[model samples]
Target: MSGLDNVIAAETRLSEVDGANGRLVICGHSLDDLAGNVPYEDVLALLLPDLLGPNPQAIRADLGQARVVAFRQLAHLDAELAALPVTEALRALMARLPDGEDRETALLQIAAPAVFVPALVRRQAGQGAIAPDPARAHAADMLAMLTGADPGAEAVRALDTYLVTVSDHGLNASTFTARVVASTRAGYASAVVAALGALKGPLHGGAPGPVLDMLDAIGTPANAADWIDAALVRGERLMGFGHRVYRVRDPRADALKGALRRLGAAGGMDAGRLALAEAIERDALTALRARKPDRVLETNVEFFTALLLEALGFPRDAFTGVFAAGRVGGWVAHAHEQIETGRLIRPQSRYVGPQPAGRAA
Candidate 1:
C-alpha cells in the first residue's frame, strides 16, 4: 500500500531484476553473458525481437544511419536549447524526433541520446558539435562526438560494456513511468520523455556522477579509510555503496569492474586511479560492515559506473544524459510491447484523507 512496495503493477518480457539474488537478465540471458560479449546493436535487436526484422546485421547498420540522421536533423538546435540541464535538453531534442511506433521511430529513440547528449555537452562548453559518422559503431561515435576525437579500441570496448550492462533492469522507476505513459496510448516519444524525467531524480540515475566526486575528494589510496569514516560519521550516504533493490553485490558492478580492469590492461586508463578505486571499495565495504553489521552494504553499479564512464571520457555532470542514451532503447521497446500486449497502467489507492462527517447519527 505504501508506494506499491512488493506490488506487481505490470507484466514485462524485456528484462528481469532479481534483486533478492542480485541477478539481471535481459531477454533470457544473464547480464554478464551479454555486456561485452555481445554488441549493443544486437542487444537492442534482441530486446525488440518483434520490431526488428530477421537481419541482425542490417538492423545494426540501420541504427548507425539513424544516429547520423538524428545528429544532422537536431544539431541545429544547440543554441536554442543549451540553457536546460543536459538530460532535459536531451529529452527536448529527442521529443523532436519524427513520430510513430514504427521501426524507424524506435531506431530514432535508440539513436537520440547518443546523438544529442554529446552535442549538448560540447555546446555547453563552447565547443562545436561533432558530426556523426554512420560508418563507426554506436559507442565509438558517441565518444567521438563528446570529445571531437576518435577513441582508442580499448575505450570503445569499455563504453560498450557499460552501455549493454545498463540497457535494461526490470521495471525500474523510470521504465515504469515510461510504461504508464505508454499505456495511455501516448507515443513512444512521450513515454521516453516521461522516463527521462524520472531518471533525473538523484535517487535513480544521478548517483554515478557523485560517485566520481567522492573518489576525487578522497584523492588517493592513503585517504580512503579515514575519509570514508569521517564522511559516514557526518551521516553522508556513500553514493555508490548501496542500492535500493539489491541485498547482495549488484551484478552490474562486477561486470563494469571487469571492464575497468580490461581498460587498464589495454593502457586506456591510469593504473593508479584504478588502484585508488580498489582501495576505496575495500575501505567502504569494511566500514559499512562494521557500522551496519546486519546489512550487506556492498558496492552497487554506480561505484564502477563512475569509474568506467570517467575512463571513457564522459564529464561527470553528463553521466545521466549518457545513461538515458543507453536506456532509451529499452524504453522504446518496452513502450511498444506495452502498446501491443499491456493494459493501461492505472492503479487505485486507499483513501487517507479526512472522511466526511456522519451527520445526525
Candidate 2:
C-alpha cells in the first residue's frame, strides 16, 4: 500500500501516538499532563534537551530572545511577506535563518514563526508589526505581538495549551519530512522549511480552518445532524469528525476543548459559540456512529482548534501557519535526533511495471 501502514520509521525520544488507545505522549509526559498544565517552554525543554539547556526559565528567556532576533532579521522582508499567504510568508522567513546544527539556528527556527506569523497578521491588516517582548512567555509574547497589547492571563494560558498540545505528535507527515531532510545532514533551518512545505499540504495541516467552515454551514445546533448526515450521504467528509491515527478520540481534542472551556469561562470566547460547537460535536459523533459503525470516527483536534483559534482572533486562512508555530519545535527536535542517531531515511518500493525484454515475469 502507498500509505506505508505499519512501517517503522525512525525511532526517537520525542513523542508517541498510540492510535489504538487514543493517547499522545511527549518525551515522558502524557498529553493530559502537558497541555494546559505546563508552559510551552517546559515542553520545548523536554523536546530539545540538549539545546534548550537545563533550566526551564533560561529556555523561556532564550526562546523569547530568539523571537526578538527573528523579528529583527525578517524586518527587511515585511513589505514583501505581507503580500504572500501567511504560511508561505512564515516559510520564507524561516528560510532566511542561517543554517546550522547549533543552538542559535534551532532557536531561530522555533522563534521565526512565533515572530513572523503575528507580524504577517498585523502587516496584512495594514498595521505595523509589534516587536517581541523578550521577557514574556512564548505564547503571551505571540498574543502581544499580534495585538500590540498585553494579553489577558486566560488567553495566554489557552494559547500555551495549544502550542504545548501540538508541539510534538510522533512521526507525523511533517515530522517525517523533517527527518528525511535531516537524515541527509541538512541543518535545522532547512529541515524545518521542508517540514513547513509538508504541513502546507491540505491533508496534514489544513483541516482546522475547514472545521470552522463545517460549523458555519451547520449554522446552529438544530441544523448539525441533518447537515452532517447530508455530507456523509454525499460521500463528503465531515471535517473534524475523524482522524487517520486515533481510533477512539484524539487526546488533543479534549485538551483543546478544555482550553476553549477555560477561555470561555474567562469571558474570552463567546459562550453561545461554544455551545454551538459542543452541540455539533455531539451530533457529528452520533451521526458518524450510525453511518459507519465499523469505522472509528470521533472528534479530532481540528474541531476545537477552529473554535479556539477563532476566539483568539485568527482568521481561517492563517490557521496552518499557527499550527507550524506549534509544530516547529518538534521538527527541529526530530531533525536534531536524526542527525545524532539516525541513518539516511531511504525507503524502498516494490516495482509493479512491465518487465524489460521478458527476462523476468
Roughly what TM-score does model 1 have, to 2 decimal places? 0.96
Clashing pairs in 1: none
Kindly list the per-residue Cα lDDT of model 2 for residues 1-361, writing each as its tens digit.
Answer: 6587788987889999999999999998899998999888899899988887757799988988898788887558746666999888888878888998999989888988988888888888888888888999899999998888889999999999999999999888999999999999889989999999999999999889988888788888998888888888999988887888899999999999999999999999999899999999998889889989999999999889999999998888889999999999999999999999999988888898888895964
- Give the clash count for model 1: 0
- Tens-digit lDDT track of model 1 for 1-361: 4666788887778898888899999988899898778667878877887887646687778888998888876646856688788888887887787777788888888887998888888888988888888888888899999898889887888888888998998788999999999899888888999899999999889889988889899999999999999999999998899877888999999999999999999998889999999999999999999988988788999999998888887788889998898888788888988999998877887787876798463
Runs in model 2 lying further than 4 Å from the true structure: 78-80, 358-361
- Cα RMSD of predicted structure 1: 1.5
Candidate 1: residue 193 Cα off by (Å)? 0.7
TM of each candidate vs. truth: 0.96, 0.97
lDDT of 2 at 72: 86
